[model samples]
Target chain A: MSAKTWLPLLALAALTGCRQDMHDPPRYRAQGSSDFFSDGRVNRPVVEGTVARGQLRADTKFYQGREGGEFVKTLPVELTKDLVKRGQERYNIYCSPCHGMVGDGEGMVVQRGFRHPPSFHLERMRELPVGHYYDVITNGFGAMSSYASRIPVKDRWAIVAYVRALQLSQNATMQDVPEAERGKLSQEGRQ
Target chain B: MSQIFHPSANTIAKVSIFGAIFFAGGLLVILNEVNRSPYVTRVGVAREQPVPFSHKHHVGGIGIDCRYCHTAVETSSAAGIPPTETCMSCHSQIWADSPMLEPVRASFRTDRSIEWTRVHDLPGFVYFDHSIHLKKGVGCVTCHGRVDQMPLMYQQNTLNMEWCLDCHRAPEKYVRPREEVFRMDYRPQESQQVIGARLVKEYKIRKLTDCSVCHR
Candidate 1:
């Protein structure tokens, strides 16, 4: 063939040769659909009456937030400063959208028109047991939806601890402050 | 023979020989550019999704944290896409009557996937872990490019291997404090080199450039 005829054809072939066969090999990725499965999902739901490794739920107080058909009054895990701090971070992410930073039910979501969750400082809310908060977080209450899928067992307890801290902070008095911390508070107040 | 080559034919032959070199060079340059352009990479191009979910409205306007919906970002290889229930958690009441959210509601009621178009799909050969990157003090804005500013999700960067190497080769150029990893509006107080170098040491971030590190 003449050079005039072949040169443009060569350039066109080179440009169009970028087939993405290697870029997307026939395989399932996370959350991808599959025709091999009847459900059209790559993930198969766990079969009934079978528990996966390390997934036994023997502790009702920890997992169910209840003991002997009643809500437990205390946390199943140890309360520590680190746990509360972790809860603070998780709370600001998960719950604070609808529950407010201080748990006053005035969160941005509520401001944008979601139903108002009651204030944590209310007498009825303050009187509720610690497990009640955990239950609500796990199973949800009223306008709230279950956060079980989003929050794990331990993180739910941590958020419960932080909610208690927020409740206490709202009603704390001068005498509630430690003797050493009292001077610091007064100094900061003066400044 | 009556002169097979005319006198003007010599001039044509010389010009064509010189033109071929320039043509070949220009073709190579154009091919290289086409490989990187948005037409090929889909970078900065927002695709049509089943629902027009706005990251700007949720993240920038409402101030919801990234982890609010993407709960597994810090712990899993895949940053989990929130299930339909996560949308209805607020939308059940927030915009319950809006026609725009009918797809979300239908997905929830029918137990079907929303089938959102994947914006940042990497080739199967390249392995990426969101947890590891966030653990090493890489901010969400580093790869996602200020998601709060995006009205609809788009691939923010070219996501080419060369772009990956740009950071892997010198992580001290982008590493921030671990606490600031989730902050969308995070700006370094001092120079990035100063902050990144200190955090790189503090976080024990290694400059991983091995082929197996990503390819495996």
Candidate 2:
């Protein structure tokens, strides 16, 4: 075919090819339940009682009337047999190997070759609010890695409660022992 | 005939005219969309598993947390599968009498990691952190899809780089409470626009409209 005869064909091809743009805008779909508005003015419902995760730092206070970077939710946990049992189970699973069953940092890993994890009964840790331990577990202390993912949030709190109980175990003296338990303790060999 | 061809002005004009037309046409095509064939990387569906494991069952059913199975996701670089030891913890007593437990037991002996076929894979060039996502309130279902309903878990989302950038472009719109961590259908209770505005001011979020926010 002569070159002149192909001009219309090339022009037609160019027109078709030019319209073949692959970047068409997506269809705007309607949102239900929670709406995503495009305009700057819109309302959002922030969860009333939840804290933002991955954002809470040691320097920020999460408790009432505290305006510092430190977390302030520190209160002795209420004693419950089930809570203690749960605490013990979690402790055995994650902590016993390094801190021992009794919180002395003498578990199997330490016995074999791991470095010593500090005893929970140390005065500095003992006096620290439960949140202190929580932070350490979530963020990790010296030579330790964060356990936030290994243990669930509630379980870590439970483990902290269990650690307090272990700390008290070393502090218990004659007056602290209950009469019923003391009788059983004092009569250990007689029976 | 040779002398006649040399003196023909019509022949010279015709050839020049065609040449000019072809050159302009080529230029116009190039100026438009005259690109070479694109390079697309496509590895099709991987081999199916012997026994389908459901993200629906463990994560959706029985309320077993993601940490129960993929335990290392939070602290370690890898989000790993539970060892046979983790499985045996409950299976030792719970499923000892079941016939299906045999494959699990066999897997333990072989030291295989269940081969749990990966469905949601991202390109190697991209870096994602499960801990950060989980902590920041991106649910498992956000990208994994309705895992609770599936028996055997497969990749739920395409997980292409564009797919990731879609959310990164406007995170507040996609982000929700940590409680909704895996539910893809979850929407922020308030309007995304309002939340985004509040988030910018409250959290001091520096950049949202920036391309580098998602891309390297």
Best by TM-score: 1
* Candidate 1 accuracy as lDDT: 0.92
| CA shift of B127, model 2, Å | 1.6
Q: What is candidate 1's lDDT per residue for A93-135, written digit by digit as tens?
A: 9999988999999999999998989999999999999999999
**What is the Å distance of residue A139 in model 1 from its true position?**
0.6
- The CA lDDT at B191 in model 1 is 99
Instruction: Kindly provide the TM-score of model 1 when superposed on the true structure, using C-alpha atoms.
Output: 0.94
Residue A51's lDDT in candidate 1: 77
The C-alpha stretches of model 2 lying farther than 4 A from their native spots are: A1-157, A160-191, B1-47, B97-99, B182-187, B200-216
State the displacement of the C-alpha of residue B53, model 1, in Å, after optimal TM-score superposition. 0.3
lDDT of 2 by residue, A92-116 (tens): 7677756788988876556645567
Which candidate wins on lDDT? 1
Model 2 Cα shift for residue A72 (angstroms):
26
The candidate maximizing DockQ is 1
Clashing pairs in 1: none
